[model samples]
Target: MAEAFKFELVSPERLLVSEEVAQVVVPGSEGQFTMLKGHAPFMTTMRPGVIEVTGQSGTVSRIFVRGGFADASPAGLTVLAEMAVPVQDLKAEQIAREIKNAEEDVADAGSDETKRVAQEKLDQLREVQAALGAPAAH
Candidate 1:
């Protein structure tokens, strides 16, 4: 069998992925980076984007993350995501609904800071939708 490195993906709900893979590409807040076996130890804040993985068996998977952080060490790569889902299962309609709700929250916000924070959340959601190639939410 081919040598593989451990990869773990964690979301608030549960451990989403735990496997031995050949490679992983994480969307760091600074930029996207790929990790292979024996990668240098490092850490980076994550952005709303895709996490690409190449399994030991050569199958590829794409997982979308809202945001969080990624760490790479001699043991392997670990991703702690705020929210994550397999790209194939993501639904545009659901994201569109979230955008609408966030808009409502912004309008109902009482304080200036609250309004700004709500708007920022809405913007991040929109960015994720766009990155997934979904049309702008109506």
Candidate 2:
């Protein structure tokens, strides 16, 4: 059996999860990485993606995060997210709506820089939608 470590998931609104976990997969800006007990200490900014958490009992929970930061230390792993929601709680309609809104933001951008940023956001939203198996926005 894998050793368990403390894990916490925090959003701006509230603490989402705090418990012992066997493993956690984080979506870092550079790439995805997994955390386990006795992991080397490090911190990395996250991208828009899903975080997969494995509990001591082997149950897996997935949380979708818009953006965030993750830290792995001797103490444990902590994720501070800009926005986080349980994958089970997310609906297809909600993802579609977000994608539509992101597309509109891209279209409404007035400057080249603004357009690029908006496009990046739109791309990320589409990726999330695909990951969730949500229908494409109308």
Candidate number achieving the greatest lDDT relative to the actual structure: 2
Q: Any idea what lDDT model 1 has?
A: 0.88
Superposition error at 37 for model 1 (Å): 0.9
Q: Which stretches of candidate 2 lie over 4 Å from their true place?
A: 108-114
lDDT of 1 at 117: 76
Give candidates' CA RMSD values in order.
3.1, 1.7
Which lDDT tens digits does candidate 1 get at residues 1-138? 346899999999999999999999898878799999899999999876789999988898999887899999999999999889899999988678768888999999999999997887788778878878887887
Q: Record all residue pairs in model 2 with backbone atoms less than 3 Å apart, i.e. clashing.
A: none
The candidate that wins on TM-score is 2
For model 1, the superposed segments whose C-alpha errors exceed 4 Å read: 1-3, 98-127
Q: Lowest-scoring 10 consecutive residues by lDDT in candidate 1?
A: 93-102
